[model samples]
Target chain A: MSDLSDERIREEAKKALREKGLKCVIGWSAEGTPTFASTEEEIDRLSFNRSCVNNLVPYLTYEIRSQRGKTRDGKDKVVVPVGVVVRGCDSKALLLLLNEKILARNEVFIIGVPCSGVVDPRAGGALFRKCVKCAMRNPVVFDVLASETVQEDEKDYSEVEAIERMSQEERWALWEEILGDCIRCHACKRSCPVCYCDECLLDPTDVAIKPDTTAEEKAHRPLWVERSVNVPENLVYHLARLPHLVGRCVDCGECERVCPRRLPLRLLTTKLEKDVKEIFDYEAAKEEGQKPLIAMSCMEDENGFIM
Target chain B: MSKSILRKDKVAEALSALGKQSVVYAPVKNKRGIVEYRELGKSASAAEIELDGKPDTPPKAIIFPQTEVLLTYRKDKDGKFEVTPARPDEREKVIFGVRPCDAIGIAVMDKVFCGGKFTDPYYKARREKVTIFSIACDGPMDSYCFCPSTGGSPAATEGSDVMMYDVGDSYYVEGVTEKGKKALEALKGQLGKPSPEQEGRKEAIVEKAKSGEGFTRKISAESIAKLDNSFDSKYWDDVARRCLSCGACTYYCPTCHCFDINDEKGGERVRTWDSCQFGIFTMHTSGHNPRAVRAQKLRNRYYHKFKYSKDNIGRYLCVGCGRCIALCPASLDITKAISEVK
Candidate 1:
């Protein structure tokens, strides 16, 4: 377990809320929910544990991703600064977000917690798949250390390897069954840090998950999803997401963890991670300002789709 | 009026026997270890019936599917169009091992889709043929159940045709309605006469549940009462800050029956599950939306569940089955949201 105490989390959050002049400090609640604290009393509810399952990085991008040039806090004239708590894997997402300029360095303060991989309470308290293969127990970046850093585990790709070894037909059947049960709730997409687009390119039928458009756009935008929620659409949605997160996904497994159907989402992301390592000789950057993976192009690229 | 005892071992026999006639749906654990309602078939039987606890998803989709085609239309070479309305199902169905909380949820959905100003023909057709066989939870099944708070007991019988109790090695069954009694006649050969001892055990369990004992999680009446004045409270923005607006909570909820109708390119009109949490659910054709912000969208769900549903239907929309609590990607507990509304 991390030596960082819940008391320390509350102390740091209180500092951010009071001293930083931020309206709220985003952190894990007592029940390990993604929550915010605007007051000292609310800060007291801040907690850190192996059960703090959600990656809080996505919450940061919601206001900034859509409705550009505006803060949701209408009453405040100045841009509001918020404090955020991020774990090791979560810090990686923050790094990618910063690299893409989706979030700016001056807009917020960060309180990083070095984590000893979160455990899945639903899976009988077993360590999460991402934690089992965790290469960094220490936060990649942070303003404060809430916990003592721990030893990291060697990366394991056995789950991905098992699927890779399966025959083409066998692989198809496995994914078919897993994807067949999808209900198109878009929980995975909405929770993902990288899937920040207001309009999904798959179907731009003017239906935005976030109300990002103006009244004119809402009225004039063509309404529709070209595909329905059948096996084909389910496959397209999930499979398209795998490649989109090739380098960006930090293997948080939030998608798999949150799937109501309990689909094996790890298989897709892990396999792509292995392939990205082999083909591009790359992993997502650990520092801000590094050019993101999809941004750079090279002659040695394994796939020729990008001429 | 018929009561019978089904041995633990004979459950498969009775269910398999029923499967030979009408469609049978019971709880089955998938390879992923998640329990869900699956149809009994050649490979499915009593050994596979998972009655330990409720499934993460309600069986609402069994009656109201996630996606359903209402009608199809096409153009002919003569420039004329033809539309064919989808047929309502006529198959008989038996749903077994439903938790009482979920049964109450179905009853609430009945109020929404089949009892309001207009009846949904699709929902009414399937609902009429389904015989609910609800199993009783002697105490709180887990940390999330609060059926009593929503005016439902651990063994609610409002929506269920039959109620079953686990008494040692056999099930003590009671038919609460005429439909439930008639359905039991099919299992006459498999059922045995209930003994006085079994009857007593079932009675004791039912009686203990009525007293509302041993539930760690409950929504106090005071908390629910506080919700009426909390519409403009700042507490909503605070709690909603963490919401991802995934719509998973509404999708998994048993009683959230909001649906959207869309016409396909081929002129087929389909109806699918919709949620107020989604930005498009309330979007007007004129590019206007009333519940546009994240906080507004999230707050609408709580109001619909607690205040509007109560004012309209005389009961809270929530049945306290806690599927939303258990399945939410973010830990937005509905019980906490309503009770602690600022």
Candidate 2:
């Protein structure tokens, strides 16, 4: 690991914040509660902790935009130009936002850091359950580097690799075994960083998943499918949840780690991620300024399937 | 009674004059064959413009950015919440050399933003202020493109404020709306009266766009409507198995506009974009995900595009842009699904 002290990093961050035209600096600070903070000075906050796991890019949506508030004189303050701390993966989100023109490059100052994986609280036991299989420990796009940079071993995809080793029938049976526990609570969706819709189709009142007794009875009753968690409905429920991450999932692994049942959620996502890389030769959040695979097109893209 | 022909060589001068008048965004090449919109400088070359092909990125970035700050709020000294409106950079922009499919995509977004009960004021202001200059595609630039399948011909003039056709050495320009007429008037000195051959060339290109191997994946609008009732159909499982749940289809789609909104505030409210294909999209606070599995999520994506969106908006959410078919990791093409929906 490259030896760079956290103290040195905070000193640099403080210096950047003091620069003229900067409104506020966004970085992770370990106040008794571990979360991202927008602070005016380094001394006012505690130093970074390994548990500062939240992606800071999401905060920019509100920090830089004009919302409700007024100065003491009753005049509105200008939209604050923010300075953000970005890791390699987080920088991709920033690049996407810039490419989308959501956040103007001039509006926010980026401090790119080469990350050496973050600790996930869900993965390495209850304390860090989400940190066990982090692929991007190194920050790809930091203005100032922090932490000792070390080359970690390649991630062990043994869980997904084992699933791949199964025959088609075994795989289907495995999914059926896992999905049989689903209760249709949307906890996974709520915790996802990318699941940002206004109205969800699975809402209780959604016409698509009709609440009418007749529709429900006809749909689940005939197949000997239990309205409760029987084999069929559970399988269907599990199938419904996986596709939502397609190109947008950055392998943050938040969904799997957050699952209360500890259903092998990461297995499903990792399998898809692996397939995407192998089949389409694409990786999610792999490059800065690269458009998400689905948002782009090429004249040479294979279209043998399209009639 | 105005027909103007601009020689291909004078295009830069015309663009420069237009840039002087307003912000002009044109295509420029990056590392790969990637074409992205960059501000047109005086030295910007017309040669960089790909009139026939689709850019690697969509034009939606100019309008509906990925992470727009809708509004910001702060606490006052008295602890009262103060709301401030995001001051948008309001400038007249002219988006030049957009393909027919992308132009239709913008029009589709117009329906979503302007035709809905809640008007997205941010999107509306940018869209209304900007002028679209569409370049007609003379032929299928990629095999995956199925603009004709989605009621869009490559040369269709459905969405452009102004439509341009390249005929040999000259570009035939026509005003599709009053805004286009005003934009054309800004370049009066560079425009020449059109010759009969230019008109003939334009027609020929239009004919070529129409006559190519039109998308063979045909599904009746009536059949798509029946999808809501056909939940037990084996097609869902068959297709879901092949689908890697990568969400390439919806993200690249011109009309697949399902999005999630959430608050990003460390302690306050901030909303950002979300997708439906994710298992988390419908997960409840109580730990119940109504759409918990891949099959249901995949079905929702198809139903949203083919059935639900059509029911709500009177048009299928998919515009046959073919971006999904081209980019899907598993090669699970929606066109094939539509064809197989018996």
Candidate 3:
């Protein structure tokens, strides 16, 4: 992880900026928060550590739209890639977004940082649960490699297995307490790389009515979840995110890290990931172009999924 | 004001005694090892209350809950809509181990809810029944505290019922108001007369709090004044470029009392805590949003904390408890945002 010094990352980023005509380089600041660096001085501020927990691949879409960079020169038809510093987990997220056709291959100039794992925000020393089971310590896809690949750990589902072993009542009680703590801030939804939506169904406001929206459309808008922050309503909020994350979730674990209540949010997504892989024999972003499990259903597929 | 001493060994008995009469909310370390103001119950005991450092979260929820119903609406047999005002929690509540910055945050919220043009019936009702027992900080709790810069001190007693200062093995408690004095009556069995040595220690703690030293994170007067002309500066976009547009800052802020009223599933009109950082917070029903960009939302939050609150309520809304800095996923330091405004 230390093979790529902070200064070396800066040097590469500065080179990428000029050669790639990049508008912004999304990276971690000295304090380990995501920051946008455009100038050489701002690029110099870019550093990586075990505290660099945020998966900045999300900003690849946010910092740059389909045109790659938000701020472009006058009448330049060429789309310049936005330079991004991505860890192994983040590179997986980037490839999934690529498979979805949300972003093109050339839309991002990926500066891959080979890493071990980020430390848990709760404990200063303990690695995050996702990091402990990380299968890839090297970027799945990258334009330029920042360092030599680090040793990776075997997948461990013990944390998820422990919860699965809980009795029906115990599991229900655990979720009730966890979801009860939710403030409905949507921090988990906002931080995820793949949760980008023009109009999120989980939004408390059911309808983003346009000027030309039909009366029938307005009348038929379903209030799937209410605005109340109670356990029942919060359960709906989290449940809505579960299905939408079928094959798309890359398990970056940013959701649990950013939670102010410190909810075990990664458990939900990671459990879903395990189930999908065990049942469907598919892993998200395992290749450049892999169809999502939800998209690749056959007639012989189990009808019990509807339940 | 009455003065007394209660040895820390007797603290749990006193709090448990008060718990019989009132639901005592204290800074109890949660499962994650973060201290938050939580109700003393079977899960969290009075003996487990952590009072040595600043709590990870402010104690705003004890008075101003994140989600509360304003009114309930239903239809009768004749189909006529019947609306009833939501009943407010009337239980006697004593918030123990409150830091002074959080106490001052409640004072600011008091101005926002009841002191202004309209008195919020809910806030007034709940605020009336609760009593604050603030622990005076001998100095800054951590590197993040900047209460003195925001019109509060480590020993500020504006919103407390009883002010408590650590005096070695015992606490030097002073009653700040009549309500505080009355609440102290519940602990009379454990109370003892304060000696001259105890009084000297209390004064020393008060003097140190008044001087306001070791607070590395603070905004200057010039910085606050400079914000007057920094409203539309490009600096906000630079700071907010990486903002995730989440409510981590606003929800954790003690003084941030902005809420949205909505009719819920049960035909109840509820007031829920809303964040200025959210993209749709300022969105119009007609598909227009004034603060559409993430940068604009960040700008509006800072402005509300510094400018709008001051213009309307006569003081800055921020308490400088640094909960925003601590809980913020982006590390958006409000002091830095205001002081670095150009």
| Order of models, best DockQ first | 3, 1, 2
Decide which is better by lDDT, 1 or 2: 1
What TM-score does chain B get in every candidate? 0.97, 0.89, 0.96
lDDT over C-alpha atoms for residue A205 of model 3 = 37
Compose the digit string of candidate 3's lDDT tens values, residues A77-107.
5666788999988999999988998888877
Measured by DockQ, the strongest candidate is 3
Docking quality (DockQ) of candidate 1: 0.51
lDDT of 2 by residue, A24-102 (tens): 6666555212223345454346344555554566555445653335889999766657676665556655665664556
Candidate 3 structure quality by residue, lDDT tens digits, B1-342: 279998899899889888888999999887766689888975688879998889998899888888898889999999999999888898999999999989889999999889978998899999999999999998888878898888888899988889999999999888899999988998988889899999999999999888987788889988988878888889988888778888889888889898888787768888888788776577665656778878898888888888888899999898889888877777778898888888
lDDT of 1 by residue, B1-342 (tens): 388998888888888777776799998888788788887884366688798787777889899988899999998999998989999888889999999988988999999888779998899999998999988988889888888888988877878999999898988888988998988888888789889999999998889789888777788888888877888898888778778877789988989998888776668898888878877778775557787777898889988988899999888889988888888888888888877776
lDDT of residue A150 for candidate 1: 74
If ranked by TM-score, best first, what sequence of candidates would result? 3, 1, 2
Candidate DockQ values, in order, are 0.51, 0.02, 0.54
Candidate 3 DockQ score? 0.54
